[model samples]
Target chain A: MSTAPNRTGAVADGGPGRAPARAARPAPTPARRALRRARTWLPGLLLVSPSILLIGVFVYGMIGWNTNLALSDKHAPIQEGEFVGLANFIALWQEARWPAAVGNAVVFTVVFVGGALFLGWLLGLLLDKGIRGEPVFRTLFLAPMAVSFIATGVVWRWLMNPAPAERATGLNALFVRFNLDFLVNDWWTAPDFGMAAMALPAIWQLAGYIMALFLAGFRGVPEELREAARVDGCSEWGVYRHVVMPQLRPVLLSAVIILGHMSLKVFDLIIAIAGQQIIADVPAVYMWAMVFEVRDPAKGATIASYLLFAVALFVIPYLVWTVRKERSEGR
Target chain B: MSVQSASGRVTAPGGRAAGTTRRGQTVKFVVLLALAVLFLLPMYVLLVTGFKPFAEATAARAWSLPQTWSGEGWAAAWEALSSGLRNSLMVAVPSAVVSAVLGSMNGFVMARWRFPGADTVFTLFLFGMFIPYQAVMIPLQQMLVGAGLMGGLFPLILAHTVYGIPICTLIFRNYYASIPQTLIEAARVDGAGMLRTYASVVLPVSAPAFAVTLIWQFTSAWNDFLFAVFLTGPNSWPVTVQLNNVAGSMVVPYNQQMAAAVLASLPTLVVYLLLGRYFMRGLMAGALKG
Candidate 1:
């Protein structure tokens, strides 16, 4: 553990992209040098070997195993079925529930991500105004983040109760008390807007986190840059629009990637809010029902693989770009 | 334009401009206050409803204070959730400790030791964070069941520890990078080998990193429902799964369900309330640094 990081730091002083070549150069005494090098590398390698082994078997190996299951005819958890290539994927693609779940996922992602970003950005701006009692407000905003989605779901399920007219309760009841009859509609039960409505609690839970991210981004904007923008005949709005917002693009990208992948893999929140309802079904919920409830590992694995594919489409690239950017910056 | 103000907003020079700024600040405050209240509405409901009797906790009276407050719900919730809470603690504590230890070692190596292709190894570890847990669910179960470790909190603990390594490593790595290189160099000059240096030098100053990773892992493992449901049966269901079952049951009153939610959430809430700064640090490290 010690030698790996220590050696990296030693090489980093020279420059990025220079370590491999320098280390590859011919040594004066091959045997002694090799012995010393191995001594340096072995401890660090040994230190991280357990983690590498676990991640290797659990993450990468599982993906391969899941893919194998998706290709085979495994219906029961214990039973290993014969090889049946692409049948599960084809079957999943043909299922009406899969498409509905996908659609709901899209809607959920759209509202959850968009709402969280906007609300969090707004809160960030509000807190950035030099207000008093900042910590108190910040605490209030971020408290929801500490709560489990199951707990949040339990409370919100009541809050968004779908009963109508004389039987209304929760938010709907509150709306009626205020004579806002038009607003007293079914939440997360309305056919078209169910998933969108579910985003409310999600936004409530996560927006504070986004707010923290944006606030950091906002604070990290050097005062000199804002001063420079202002001196260039820019108004306050202009300072933000041209100077500050651009600097926050990376923060925004990070937030989007984080929230986006989460939205795709959403399971606990939806299940907690509404127990695997078809109207609000997401791929995760479908995958759960398929594997655990329905006992069809093949179909479940297929859905999971698709979800992985969808997530990897964005996450892998973002991760690569981030690493490459850091490397280019010579960090 | 006083430098003493916490935020970056500059006050205008003129009194009139200052008055406008003050007014704007008031408006901002009111808007923030209103939003804060709105955000906290569900929490208020949870508390109030949990204190109410079943009849008073109905949706129509959800906004009303209970005429006759009772601990019946709280008592019942405690009865239903006490075991699950214990289970959660059992799973979360070990998971947090093990992950923190492993992550510290991995992070120490990644950040300070320096190896060829270390960045590649780090990136591979990071990719594990984004993969849907579903992808690993089936195989992990098979492996555990085959090994006869499928039941109880063991599988859940094992899963949390393995899955947590990536984020914990990321947090610890970023943290260790910020430590001065001279310190490590000084330790090395004392003729301390890698393990000894880490144990005596790096580990001492790692409290903040440890705190962040521990709080993060604990909260995640505690809040986790997916793995808890899959890996553990009724006897070992964590607070989350138990809360779900309690809330989902038709016979359970709304008050008990709300009470159960509160009970289930209390530990993480307390942790956040106490160590929120470190939690936010962990949050920022995960999002921004990565």
Candidate 2:
């Protein structure tokens, strides 16, 4: 099964023809050795080549092409405009809404990622207590993950009605019914915290994902480890805080990276809930409006490039680290 | 693997088997119940509002049961979303199968077959997963337009399939990596070439992997909104796009909109509920093993 060549530079073949007689003979010529090597790797390369080609063209090639488009003064998708250097980026910086969009994105990332992590961890901890109907609760928590954000946004927009006092609806109306009138406010219409309000739905959709990750992490903690901790005079809380939580750091990191990147690219939900509103605008929604609605390819591409750059700031390092860890784990 | 010890000495008051006290368990359950109810509130609203007649579907009465339940909303939703659902199926099914097949091949090679710079290639593949689709959307749209493949389900299928490569590959690669090398070696020893070995030894036990990738790809492609908006036209609008349109229209009744939302979410939701265990496996595999 090993690919390493044994001593004497003889390639070990897996065929039935791999006999002692061949090993005893004089070494084959370099050309023959190369052919033997080709026979092993050729099929493997062929198997993976299609994916490599597709990813090369669609992912890497497109990124390069997008950067070029961003640099150019292209006003529309159809036109290949002249190279304008940083004019597009300059325009985006000068636009009043650009900084607002960035601010909204920051607010969104904080609320969405932080809220989902906290809620998901709490739910995961609750589920790990060996409760009955664990699957039922897990399913309920995860049901939103199954539903499309578009659908969730539709329901949430109704729930977050921005109507006046007498015309209240959705959650506001429900609050009125429960005499919790103080809790009712404009959800996604408030100028300052609109993006944070939008994060409510995002958190609802993703908290279950974090829960699932942490639950898996919990399962990986051996029963013996907990028992040993208990035997060492550790209470249940101590066992969880000292032993279990430490083991879940990787899961936490994964959840944060996953949720962070997702929040950075938040688009569909916002568009579904509020169509291109400045109050809730993130770069992603702004990019969509720029490209499709305004037909300004250069500016749109500039915004997109920044977004890609922002995501790559974290994702590329994480990917590289994970790969290195996997390799170092002897895979 | 068990280490048998002196039972009385090891028998602590609170052990893994003995479980927590009844009161603590009840508190946890009660907390979980409250959370579940909170989590399910939106769904309850969706269902209750959908069943309500148009007049009663307004926000003020959103929490109440339908005063006079009617099927008009469901009927209208079906009428609007049915075509989009078909279009989505057209996009999702092939996207899932094609990506899964390609990923299986790539995974088998990467996991079992050693090649120069394989890890680099694998890492490159992984990088594709995290990329903002916006970065590539412009080029992809122009490329499709230039190639006369724009404005239909084809571009969506292609986009999803191409984008799906990294994740599906990661899933299958991790899955196949855990398969003992001895099995592959045994197949090779029996005169099976690489393809033959994969066909005979690898593909049989690949059902779980296939289930994971196919379900993953299907759900994503089905739920996609950005690509559907940018890549396709009204003629090829998927359920998500159609749902957005329905929900966006001010003229559409709230009941109908709720029904449409439910209709749009049903397929992936149904798949998720029926195959939840496998779905969770896919989630864990993508997250932890990435």
Candidate 3:
């Protein structure tokens, strides 16, 4: 129900007699109309002022400040500063470790995103078919999303650590049985398997999130379509492949973009699991090291800027796609 | 709605066929049960291992329960984590409440009133969400240091509040849009000013959305580790950071680590379980619609 207009615009204006009394009113003056518009908007602007102020100062402002820092050499002390004119960027681009870190980041992103999407879709498909105790199972699967990465990282680290033979968990034991201890060697010695090991914890934690998104998408599909496919004697797999998968495209796209963006910025999981000492090259980890561990603000800012550039490469496309999709959907 | 399939079979709405659906439902249940077990494995490992002694946890049978039950690890974790928990709550509660309140107001204005620069402001906020936190970490830290808030809870709170506004505003604004515009119009006609309309009319009607935002912002703030680690000193560290410290200590004890992890995560877990239904519904409503 709507609110009632009152006299002086301060109290209820719509009771049985009030509405009829106001109905036979004269139109407002142009100046009064303008005043009314201003009155309506004034409070809105005031209400939102704090949020706009904070975001403008910290988010946009800091980003601008970071870009400036990237162009300078101020690693020695916070106060001491000198403009490097792309020297840091040049050094970052030519550095052997940076390329390796970039490669590792790319690999981690691809595997985590691809693996989570595949496994999540499979599980979602299974669960969508009128599963028993559906709510219970759904909650169980989605539990990981609720837990902080800090906890997950520690748990996974224990699960992955090779030195502590007494506390060796799943991955460690498997490696021992297979005599694959070399897999845990330093990245400088054997990078491929080390990167894969680093990527596993992220995939484990994130797959469930993808499943939840897919489950929501699966629910949105009309049951009539599935029933019709079944009545036609098409196999269950065939129906999912041809009918259900196509309908889930938007959901998958959104999920991928979100996961991709998260993977690019992933820091806590890697740092918690490997520690900054071991794998010092992944952009986030490297950036964290520079800022916190090394106390090199200029270099840290440079790394951060590059990371932002990388993230923008992915985000711009996703935003464009989402906007286009929203427009098509008449949103 | 009536594009028939190539097989030429007519289907009922929502695909609810009586007998055929029941038979297929049974098969589906079986498959789902197996998947559920797979999903529950890690949780089972975590819960069981938390109760075990260090020795037992270190044993080859890591997935199984302890030979004898003990709550000592949990007690130790509690004792060790109490300080961190206090710090976490101190930062998280304020950050969440402040962000949610301010964000809701921002959202209410943006959604209901078409003001000049509102869209620009909203877009600018949205841009913040896409930028990685790592990208701004250095400058933000330096800024905090320069402001003399370094190594304190203030920086962490400020950073989280800044990061939280974008998503919180997006969620609330979208939800507010679905609210019938007539309510606000009526409030205006009744001589309600902006603040009065928001407090007496808008907010009271948006309880469900507020609850969802509260939980989300709280959990995010509580779960934050990067800022807690980088910005705050030891005294101001959150539970997540404390849990990492427990994990990183020289003589790392698995049971204690597990216990601390469990303890650190319990609040958010409880929040999730209590509001899981509303949380999921709110998320789906926003995600699917927007």
Name the best candidate (by DockQ).
2
Question: Higher DockQ: candidate 1 or 2?
Answer: 2
Q: DockQ of each model against the real complex?
A: 0.50, 0.54, 0.41
Ranking by TM-score: 2, 1, 3
A264-306 in candidate 3: lDDT tens per residue? Answer: 8878887677777545358888887777678888888888898
Encode model 1's per-residue lDDT on A269-329: one tens digit a residue.
9989999788889999998998778988888889989999999999998989998887677
Better of 1 and 3 by TM-score: 1
lDDT of 2 by residue, A67-137 (tens): 99999988976786999898888878786899988988999999999999999999998877556788799
Those runs of model 1 whose alpha carbons end farther than 4 Å from true positions after fitting are A1-27, B1-20, B288-290
Residue A145 in model 2: lDDT: 89
Q: How many clashes in each structure? A: 12, 0, 6
Candidate 2, B41-110: lDDT as tens digits: 8999888889988888776676889989999899999999999999999999999999999999998888
Which stretches of candidate 3 lie above 4 Å from their native place? A1-36, A163-169, A174-190, A225-236, A320-331, B1-31, B281-290
Question: How much does each candidate deviate from the true structure in C-alpha RMSD?
Answer: 4.9, 3.7, 5.3
Interface root-mean-square deviation for each candidate? 6.4, 4.1, 5.4
> What order do candidates take by DockQ, descending?
2, 1, 3
lDDT of 2 at A243: 94
Give all TM-scores, in the order shown: 0.93, 0.94, 0.86
